[model samples]
Target: MLPEAKYRFLSEDVKRRSGLVLGPEKGYLVESRLAPLARTEGLASVEAVIDLMMRGDKRLCEAAAEALATHETFFFRDKTPFDLFSEVIAPALKPSRAGRAMKIWCAAASSGQEPYSLAMLIDEMSGLRADILATDLSGKVLEKARAGLYTQFEVQRGLSIQRLVKHFDQAGENWQIKPELRAKVRFEVGNLLDDFSRYGRQDVIFCRNVLIYFSVEEKAKILARLAGMLADDGYLVLGAAETVVGLTDALKPAPGQRGLYVKADSGASAPVVFRSATAAA
Candidate 1:
């Protein structure tokens, strides 16, 4: 168990750096997540790791905070959101911007699965084109995402056998995403706490599942920033359990869409985008 002061410092430092709220009850998580980092740094114990951090070792402190980030993801996690993307959003773009590619940002794309799943869905959309920019806070996970390699267990989690065969090539005991599919996503290291306006406006922002770690105020701040960068007609996809209802006024939910949000006063009716200009009219 970590000493109370050390625990408080660690939690506060992590929240300051990553906006992740690690409550006092999450001590087990801190210990587990920091153990490998501790071992790598040749620390005698997790306490020693905290000791170095308390002394303000910048590099170690950064690594320790990053180590606590949750990267749990799989291909097409929570299928319905991707379904809405393909069925509603894809067809919606066909009429107004049929030939032009749309921009999609996977704001917390861990290890590439969600972005790759969307890339595959884009391919299935007849005559549709899109660019995917997937970002995460962890360089270690981004490296794995860039490689697009997955073990059998990893591939099996959310991928159907047909999708597995169609999109991945066998690599001994593992599977690698096809080069074409791999080219569809560009992965980068991004911290939600940092400025990212350089990536510019996006038509679809998949900032799913990561916001639950933040306080309500922090969630509102992040959503407001995201709203600033979202095209008026664009969609902001959150995890099913997440909602902007009490957090921010900048966004309103897409009626009947479980995790979709859009800009307030968006052209998309009731914040649910139409399939074509005619449909909107």
Candidate 2:
């Protein structure tokens, strides 16, 4: 067990820099995430790792950041959000823009699963012109996303047997994503707490399950930046349990959809008034 002082130090460091709150229940997560780095550095424990990490050493700091950012994600882990994307979000793109192409951003795309899942949905739409921009804080996962490979179990989670057989080809014990789907997604490095100017305009943003790691202030800041990238009519989709209430009024709850938010019109300065555009039309 990490000493109380050590835990407080590490937790405070993480919270200060990344806004990731580390409570007592998540100590094991810290140990597991940082153990590999400690091992590589010939350190004996998480305490020693923390000592080295806090010394203003850029390299150690980066390693610690990567460890904290590494997380688990599976293909179509939650079907409802993707279903919302397909049925509500995707269809809402202007008809005149059908062949003009649409942009989808998957923030914190771990190992490519979520973005690839979005690609699958896009492919299912016979005539929609869409592409996926998947980004992560870790370069390691971004490379994996670019490679489009996954272990059998990684591919299986949240993916039905039919999707598995249809979208992935077996390579020994691993499954490789089909080229057609892989071709539609482009992966790059991104910091959710930093500027997203490189991402260009987006019609849909999938920032699922990421904000829970951030402090409330950080969540609000991220929502503001994300909302800026959205077109006036674009949508933001967060994790099922996450919400933008009290974070930003720029995003209004998308009517009849549980986890969807639409960007409020420019020049507006209040908590978004929830109105169903579909109903209004």
Candidate 3:
């Protein structure tokens, strides 16, 4: 078990670097998440890993923070958001971008499923030229995503057999997405805490299931930046568990839809207030 002091320091460090707010009660999480990294480094305990991190081991510290990231994802996770993309967003954007390519950003794309899923949908659409960019905080996950390979269990999660056979080929026990499908999207390492201005105006942004880890203020800040990056009619999809209601008015729930958020009338941000991650729980 980590001492309360060490745990607090770790939680704050994680917040500073990654915007993930691990409150004091998450000591067990820090211990468990860093254990494998500890063993890999031949350190005796997670405490030793933290001690080195506190001592200014920059590389190890970033890896430890990356370790805390929740990479739990599967193809077409939660269903509705992808449906909204294909059924609503895509059809709406096709006309406006009749000659140009549509830009889609999967901001927190954990292991590529989200962006790859988007790619597959785009493949099915006729006369729609789209560019997909998927990014994550961990370089390790981006490597896996770039490879476009998934285990049987991973493919089975949300992929139907028809889509699976259509998009992937058996590589031993794993399935690799077809080369053409893989080429449709680009994967990169990105941090939501950094400036997002370089991405330009995106037609759609999928940042689902990511903001719940941040404190209220951090979530608000991220949403405000995302709003600026969004096209006038662009949609932002968050996890079903997350909402922009109390955080920022820069975004509002899309009418008659569940997880999609669109810009508010003023297209401006409201003030953010400090809210503890623990209290949010």
What are the per-residue Cα lDDT tens digits for candidate 2 across 1-281? 88888788788877777777889888777876787678778999778888876677667777786677656788887888999988887777747467688888999898999998988877778788787899999898889888887766567579888888888888775688888888899888988988887889898899999899999999999898888889887889999899998999778777678988887663343345687779755
Candidate 1 vs 3: which has more TM-score: 1
User: Tens digits of per-residue lDDT for model 1 on 1-281?
Assistant: 88899999998888998888999898777876787678789989899998888998989878987878756688899899999998777776567666677999999998999999999998876787888999999888999899998867679988999999899999876789999999989999998878889999899999998999888878889999999999888889999999989888889998788888888877737545566667655
Stronger candidate by TM-score (1 vs 2):
1
Which model is ahead, 2 or 3, in terms of lDDT?
3
Question: Compared with the true structure, what per-residue lDDT tens digits does model 3 show for residues 165-243?
Answer: 8999999867899999999899878899998788789989999888988888899999999988999888888889988
Candidate 1 lDDT trough over 10 residues, lowest sum: 268-277
Q: Alpha-carbon error at 153 in model 2, in Å?
A: 1.2
Q: State every prediction's TM-score relative to the real structure.
A: 0.72, 0.70, 0.71
Off by more than 4 A, model 2: 1-70, 266-281
lDDT ranking, high to low: 1, 3, 2
User: Model 3 off-target regions past 4 Å?
Assistant: 1-70, 266-281
Candidate order by TM-score, decreasing, is 1, 3, 2
Model 2 residue 9 lDDT? 78
Estimate the TM-score for candidate 1.
0.72
